[model samples]
Target: MTIASCGSVSATTLGLPNSTAIPAEKARLPKGLFVAKIPVSAKTKQRLANDIESITMLSLLQARNTKLAAGTRVPEILVIGLRLHEPNAAVPTDIVELIAMQRKSGMLFVCVRDADFEGTTRQECAFAVRRALPARAGHTTTSKVFASDWQPAGEATLNATDPAVDSMDALWESLCSQVILDDPSPIDVNTRLARRMQIAQLTAQVDKLTRDHQRAKNPEQRNEIYAKLHKMKRQLEELQGQ
Candidate 1:
C-alpha cells in the first residue's frame, strides 16, 4: 500500500530540518508484500514481519520540492528508520539491500534499538547508507552498505557540508560520509566505500588465517597460515594507507 504522507513534523531527532520531516504510519509496508513490486525470499519476508517493530519514514527529500539539488538519476532521498522488536537483534543485510534496490532511491536507514549506556537503558541508533547507481539493462547496482557505529539515538547529525554541489548525487555522497564516522578523509565517498569493502574482505581473510594458524598441528602448516595472514594484513594496511 502506498503510505499516506503525514503532515510536516520536526525531524530534529535525525538532525534533519523540520521542513523535511514527513512522518508516515508505522505500518508503511503492506502485510504480505515487498516494496516497489520486487520479489523477496520467504525468509526475508518473515524476518521483516518478526524483527521489525515499526517502520517510519522520517524524511523524504527530493530535488524539486527540497533545497537539495537535482540528481541526474536520483530524484529523491529517503531517510527510513526501522525500530527493532529486540534491542540486540539485527536486521539482515540482504533485507536492507533488497529494500533499497526495490525502492530505487538514495536511502539512509536508521536502526533503532534500546541499549544500556552509562548505567541507564536508553535508545540508540546506527546509520546505514546504500546508494543505488543508475540502472543498467533494467538491473540496479547498489554500493556496499556503509554504516556508522551506534550512538545515542538522535544525537548524531549529518555533518558533511558542500555548498557548491548542485545535485542530489553529491548530497547523497555527503550523507554517506556523515554515516561513516570513522573516515574523515577528503577522498570521494565512493572511493572511501570501496576501500572500506576491501578492508572488510582482507579482515575476514586474516581472521580465517588466524584460526587456521591456531588449529595447525604441524610447524609447516602454521608457517603457511602465518604467511597468508601477513599478506592479508599488508593488503589491508595499503588500503588503509597505514
Candidate 2:
C-alpha cells in the first residue's frame, strides 16, 4: 500500500512503504523489472524454464538482433509450490523434500499463473520474466503484496547470475582505466587472463548464494544463508569498489 518514489524510471520496486526512499537499500537487494509466481508442479517447473528462455538473449549480438537489451525482461524469482499443504493432504510426498533434491544441483524452479496482471483469468501465461508488470511493483509477496500465496521472492537473477562473468568484465574495464586505481597494468595478456579467471571463480560462489537466499522457502534457512551471502557480497564489492 505504501510506495516510495525514487524518480527512477527503470524497474518498479515493491517493498515496504518507503523502502525505495531509503538510500542503499535497493543496492544491497536487487529488484526485478517484472514479477509473477505459479504453483510448483512438474509441468510448472518445466514451464518456468521455458518462461525464462522466452525473455533471455543468449548473446550480445542476439540481443541486438531481437531488439532486446541484456538486462531487459530478465527474471528474479520467488519460488512457489514447494510447501506442505497442512493436515492429511495426501498429495505426492513432501514438496519441499522434492524441491530440496533439485536444490542440491544449485538450480531453482518456480512459476506464476499471472503475467501483467491479466485479471487471474488463467488463460494467458506469463513466464518468470515478462514484458509488462503492475504500474508499481510488489515482488515481496507480503501481506500488502502477494498475500494469498505468501511466497519468498529472492534477488538471485536480478543483476548478474554469474559473479565470475560480471566481476571479471568489470575488473577488465577497470584495468583498462589504468589512469586511476593503479590497476596493476594489463600490459601482459596471459597474466590478465589468469588473474581474471581466478577472480571469477572466487566470486561465483558468493553470487550463487545471493540468488539462493532470496528464493528459499524457509525463513530460518533463508536468513542463515543470507547472512553469509551479505557478508560475502560486501567483501567482494569492497574489493571491486577499490
Q: What's the lDDT for all of these models?
A: 0.66, 0.31
lDDT of 1 by residue, 1-242 (tens): 23322121125555565556664454265535554376778887878888777666777777765576688767788887777777655544665676676667688877777777778777777778775433346676756665678776657566434564456777676776777635433247656655666788888888889888999999998998898899888888888883
Clashes of 1: 0
Task: Look at candidate 2 and give me any clashing residue pairs.
Answer: 37-111, 37-112, 38-111, 38-112, 40-81, 78-153, 154-214, 156-211
User: lDDT of candidate 1 vs native?
Assistant: 0.66
Instruction: Give candidate 1's error at residue 137 in angstroms.
Output: 15
What RMSD, rounded to one decimal, does every model reach?
5.1, 20.0
RMSD of 1: 5.1
TM-scores for the candidates = 0.74, 0.21
lDDT of 2 by residue, 1-242 (tens): 32222111112222211311223222221112222233456654543343222221111112222222332322112222211222222222222233333321111122222222234322111112111111225564221111122122232112222223223333232222221112433244334434444456659979789789878999999999988888877777765654
In model 1, pairs of residues that clash are none
Separate clash counts for every candidate: 0, 8
Segments in model 2 whose C-alpha atoms lie over 4 Å from true places:
1-195
